[model samples]
Target: MTNRLVKHIQNLLPDFTAGEKDLSPFITTRVVKKDEILLRENEPCDALYFVARGCLYLYYEHHAVKQVIHFALENWWITDYKTFAMKGPAVYSIAAMEDSELIVINRQQYEALLNQYPMVALYFNTIHERAYGAALLKQKTYATTTKEDFYKYFKNTYPDILARIPDPIFASYMQVNLEELVQLKQSGVS
Candidate 1:
C-alpha cells in the first residue's frame, strides 16, 4: 500500500528521504468513525496522528463547552504537543470529525526515527515551524480582525475546510455563535 504520510514527507524534502520501509515499523494506520475520540482530555497521549484521509479535530472542554483549537484535514497532523513531549496528560482531545484514516506514531517511534534519519528530523522541524507560524498567525488574525472580517477571511482562505467542518465545530473554532455563522453563510458576505 502507498504510504501517504511517507509521500507527504518526501514531497516536503526530496533531498533527504524516509521511505515506507523506514517508517513502517514505527507507525500504525487506523481507520476511525466520526466522533470517535483518539485522545481525550486529561488522558495519556502517546501518539502523533497524521491524517491520511478525512478530518480530525483538537479541542478542549471549557465550562462544559468544547472550544476547538484546530482541525486536521487530509494531509495534516494533530496531537497535543505538550503531552507528546512531556509524556503527561493531554490538554486537548483529538477526535475524528469524519470517518478518517490516520497514521499514528508513538513517542518512542518518534525518537527512534529522529535519531535514525537526519532527513526525518528535518521533516519534523519544518512541520513544527509551519505549525507554530500558523498558530501565531491565527492568533494575530483573530486579535486584529473584526468578527465579520474573520468570518470572511476564513471563508475565503479555507473554503474546503469551511465546507467540511460542521457548524458547531466551526463556530467553536471561529469563536462565533452557530446562528451567526449561519447568518454569515447566508449573508453572501464572501
Candidate 2:
C-alpha cells in the first residue's frame, strides 16, 4: 500500500521523494464497498481520499434529487474542499461506486506536510491548478457547446465513465436528464 501510494505520488511529481520514511506515516488505507457513502452531505469533511483502486462519486442533493458532480476513478482524488478547508458542513456526498480501496490523509496532516515540505506543496498546487483548469473547460463546454456536442465532448473526455457509472449519475454530471442522455447516446453523440 505504501509502495503504491509512493508510486502514485511519483506519477504526479517525478521529483518527489519522501525516502520511504516520511511517506510511511502519512497514509492510511481502507476498503469501501459499493454504494457505501464515504462522506455525507452536511457532515464535516476532515480528510481527502486518494483512490488506489475502484471508483467514487461526489454528489449533492437539490430539491430532493441527488446530482453527481464528479466521478473519481483509479488514481484520482476525492474530497469536499469547502467543508475540509472552511470547517463548514459538506455540500457534497462522496460514495463508492464499486468495491474500492483508498488512502486517506486528514486536513491537519496535509497542511502540516505543505508547511514542512516545499515539494509536497508544489505537487498539491499543480493538482489544484489542473482541477481548476478542468472545471473552467467544463464551464466553457457547457456554455458554448450544443447539447449533442457536449455529449460528444464528454464521451471524448471520459470514454470509460459511461460503462463504469450508472446513466442517471452520468446524466447528472452532464447536467442533462436521463431521457436526453439516452437520446444523445442513441444518436451517437456520446
Candidate 3:
C-alpha cells in the first residue's frame, strides 16, 4: 500500500521516491468500510486521506439534510480543508462510499513532509490551484449555463463519476432535482 501511495505521488511529482524510507513513518494506512465516516461536521479535521482504492464522499448538512459536495476516487486526496487549515471545527463530513484503502497523514506530519520535500509541496500547490480553478469554473458555469447545460457539463467533466455513482447522489452533487436529472438522462442530454 505504501508503495502504491508512493507511485501515485510520483505520478504527480516525479521526484517522489518510495525507497528513500524518509516518508514511511509519516503515513499510516487504514481500511475504511463503506459508509464509515472519516470526519464529521463540527469535529476537528486533524488528518487528510490519500485514497489508494475505492471512493469517498465529502458532504455537509443543510437544514437537516446531507448534501454531497465532491467525490474522491483512487489516487485522489480528501479532507476538510477549511478546518485543516484554520484549526477550527469542520464544516463538512467525509465518508467512505465503498470499502477503501487510504494513507492517512496528520496535519503536522503533512506539513513536515512538505517542508522536507519541496517537490511534494509544489505538487500539492499545483493540486490546490487546479481545485480552485475547477471551483471557479463551476461558479461560472452555474451563472451562465442552463440546467441542461450544467448537467451536460458535469457529465463531460466527470465521466467516471457518472458511470460509478448513484443518481440521487449525483443529483445532490450537481444541485439538480432528481426529476430533472432523470428527464435529462431520458432525453439523452446527459
Candidate 4:
C-alpha cells in the first residue's frame, strides 16, 4: 500500500524531488465498506482522500433531502476544502458508493509536506483549479441546457460514471428526479 501510495504521488507530481517522495511515508490507506460515511455533516474533516478504488459521493442535506454535489471515482480526490483548511465542521457528507480503497493525508501531515516541499503545493493547486473549472462548466451546462441535452452531455462527458453509477444516485447528482432520469434514458438521449 505504501508503494502504491508512492507511485500514485509520483505519477501525479512528475516533478517531485527526492525529498518530496519522502513525504509518502505520511500517507495512509483506508478500506471503506459500501455506504460507509467517511465524513459526516457538521464534523471536522481530518483528511483529504484519494480514491484508489471504487467510488464515493459528496452531498449535503437540504430540507431533509440529500443533494449530491459530486462523485469521486478512482484516482479522484475528496474533501470539503473549506472545512479541511479552516478546521471547521463540514458543510457536506461523504460516503462510499461501494467497497473502496483510499489513500489519505491528514491536514497536519499535508501542511508539513508543503512546508518541506514547496513544489508539491503546485500539484495540489493544479488539481484544485481543474476541479473548479469542471464545476463551473457543469454549472453552465445545467443552467443553459434542457434536461435531455444535459443528460446526453453528461453521458458523453462521463461514460465511466454512466457505466458504474446507479441510476437513482446519478439522477440525484444531476439534480433530477428518478422518473425524469428514467424518461431521459428511455428516450434514447445517450
The best candidate by lDDT is 1
Model 2 local distance difference test score: 0.84
Per-residue accuracy of model 3 over 47-155 as CA lDDT, tens digit each:
9898889999999989887798888888888899889989899999999988999989999989888778768877778778887787788889977998889888888
Off by over 4 Å in 1: none
As for lDDT, the candidate ahead, 2 or 4, is 4
The ten-residue window of minimal lDDT in model 4 covers 17-26
* CA lDDT of each prediction against the hidden true structure: 0.88, 0.84, 0.85, 0.85
Per-residue lDDT value at 121 in model 1: 80
Candidate 3 has its poorest 10 consecutive residues by lDDT at 14-23
Give the number of colliding residue pairs in candidate 1: 0
Q: Estimate each model's TM-score.
A: 0.96, 0.92, 0.91, 0.92
Candidate 1 lDDT, 31-102, residue by residue in tens:
999999999999999999999999999999999999998889888888999888999999999989999988
Q: Model 1: clashing residue pairs?
A: none
Q: Which stretches of candidate 2 lie over 4 Å from their true place?
A: 19-21
Q: 89, model 2: CA deviation in Å? A: 1.2
Q: Worst 10-residue stretch by lDDT in candidate 2?
A: 18-27
Q: Rank the candidates by lDDT, best first.
A: 1, 4, 3, 2
What is the TM-score ranking, best to worst? 1, 4, 2, 3
lDDT of 4 by residue, 1-190 (tens): 5555556556888766554357666677899999999999999888998898889999999988888979898878889988998999999899999999988899988888788778778878877998999989999999999988999998998887888888878888888999999899999887
Q: Cα lDDT for residue 109, model 2? A: 76
